[model samples]
Target: MAMFVHLTAAANTPRIRRAGIRADSRGQGGVRGVYCFPVLPSYTLTHQWLRELARFGPKGALSAVHVRLADAQEVLVGHYRDRAKDAQQWLTAAEAVARVAAQPDPRGWEVVVPRAIGAREVHRIRAVPQVAGWRYLPGAHGTRPCTCVGCRIRGEYGGRRLRERHPHPLDGPPPPVPVLLARIEAAGDPGDQAALLDALHWFGLRRRGPVDRLARLAAHPDPAVRRELVWAVQGWSTPGVAELLDPLAEDPHPDVREAVADVRELMDEQES
Candidate 1:
């Protein structure tokens, strides 16, 4: 599914002129930088560029392409400085930036510059996507992670500014527990089910549901299912949950015992 977004011009930027220029470039529409949110659980980076295309009209017909730079384009150095020798990371970052710069559209442009950089350190250039051949330059800038979740995970490239990408998880956010649980129950792929369950547990979303649903999970036959149920019940301490939790606490699986211990601590706290 496409990531939803609101794309707009960076104040006072003129809509491309239409007169002699082709009507397509005449500013009937605009271009903008696509934001990518990788931290959110979907692991699907929000396709800001596609969203921009949707908003600005067809890439060939749009008039102005607005790029949100001041906030999103400065984190390329730290992500690469130390890991220069790591080919995979370097290549991934390189490819993402290249893909962004090489987009085929005349109505848009990408505004890229270094953050915390002084005028003397580098020549700051804004590469409109249609202009072609744009790249980043390096310099001393107090860089931060890209504010947009996708950029944070995917990283950006500014001409010569080769920075490192952050190591945050790519999944943006977990689907609501009920949603994930239902998918797990319906999914034929064990890996998919396990991945969802693990995500639910990792994000600490387990507390939002009923202990009984989880207790019933303990006997699900599939060891993986039983294992995840253990995590789901790990911290449950609702008053009537003891009956549901006690058996799993002594279940043959070490995972079950560990979950029981975890829940016991919750019960102990409630008693205190």
Candidate 2:
């Protein structure tokens, strides 16, 4: 079934122009060459390139292209590869950058300059937070795991098994509860809030820390945040925890209500 879908997708894929290469209508839409790097272009620029690539079928474009620099040319390649729906692509733009600049830094960490190819230029590339000591450099063919002290220790002692080590998190202790709470309170971005909430749940579970503040976030404007909050509150049988969850039964979002139902069922099971 998966093979049929793959073949169907390949057949229906539109072609696009590749960097330093012209469009070949007669050729299969599969990628000819990919320009791999580590950064991504702006959304506007990415959309423009996607529009241009769609002119050709999917087979004619590259499968996975990375842009190290934010240059127009590089961004075009990255966006094209992403939109081409190539199953071969792995790392996100941020991951690609981390892989390229994986060398150890005496100052603690290295930085990548985010210069674009043409008029649009960024001052610096934002650092992608990674697990401690897991430096990876992209090889001539693809990316490989770093054998640094941190990565090595993580492989053995950390949850990462040898086979599952490729996409492991950075080594180092998690941030303090206060720090996470501060970020959650101040975070305006929904994505940031969601991640912090997830981290809080794990941190609380491991340490059995206080989560009273998290319960307050049930009123968060974003339904996604509320849903995550529901998950975070599970297994928390503290005083007033049930009262805090009662109102969520009538939550505006159906998913949130469903999560509340699941939690209620679990609680009933525990009592019985």
Candidate 3:
């Protein structure tokens, strides 16, 4: 996902365009500074929506939230000419809503919305298969409620109270390390490949064998895959992991080089 902030001349002052809205900032030392709002890709926006839902109970009406989100998206589409950018804004808005609905709070914090309206929008978003790696909702499966002490305490408050609880893990065991490794190897799509690498990092590989398997991807054709490979190597302290990373220090891509530097710095910190 690429973020673009456009600066244009307007009358005597410079106007900054971000998220499709223009704002004026005071000139400093005869130079006008451009104000830029961080442009969040659809994936990031969906993640943010999940975080917001987890923190605050979804009390507002769905229509109201939809309108607000739509306005933000319209502004983005207007400013950015890229069709992908426009698609991302719409997809992010819809996916975020669907994720919130799927993970309804049992404690009644989940906002009630017209099922038809919400479902219609979700269906529309899902119909477009162009967006790769679009999952309906993450962590939606499993029936077992969290038995953690925090969950237990939060359960006592009922619908009236809004107490924050750490999200309970789902009931099922995580996918085996080998399965994830194979998925990473088989993934042909850049986005899917990157995501799998990230998941592998999160799941962690205890054995040196899996790390060795992952390190081989450092020579992958795509820079993104190489970068993720570099990231995955940071956690492993195996004997030849340094050997795997050393060649990457001279990688043509700045991002790959930076990742190698980060790993080296972290290794230094650990050794010291």
Task: List pairs with backbone clashes in candidate 3.
Answer: none
- Winner on TM-score between 1 and 3 is 3
lDDT of 1: 0.37
**Poorest 10 consecutive residues by lDDT, candidate 3:** 106-115
Best prediction by lDDT:
2
C-alpha lDDT of residue 207 in model 3:
31
Model 1 deviation from native, Cα RMSD in Å? 19.8
Candidate 2 lDDT over residue span 184-266, tens digit each? 76765443665666565554333233557667677777777787677666666566667777888899998789778777765
- Give a tens-digit lDDT track for model 3, residues 178-255: 777667767754436656655555443233446566666777767877776776656665678788888889999988
lDDT of 2 at 35: 29
Best by TM-score: 3
Instruction: Rank by lDDT, highest first.
Output: 2, 3, 1
Cα lDDT of model 1 by residue, 1-272, tens digit: 11111222323123221111111111101211222221112211222233334322322322222222222233221221233333212123233344434544312222212222222222222223332221121221355534233232122224113222433353334467676656655654443556545644643433445555445565655566566665555454454556766677777777567556755655564464
Task: Report the alpha-carbon TM-score of model 1 versus the true structure.
Answer: 0.31
Off by over 4 Å in 1: 1-167, 170-173, 188-196, 199-203, 236-240, 266-271
Give the least accurate 10-residue stretch of model 2, judged by summed lDDT: 1-10
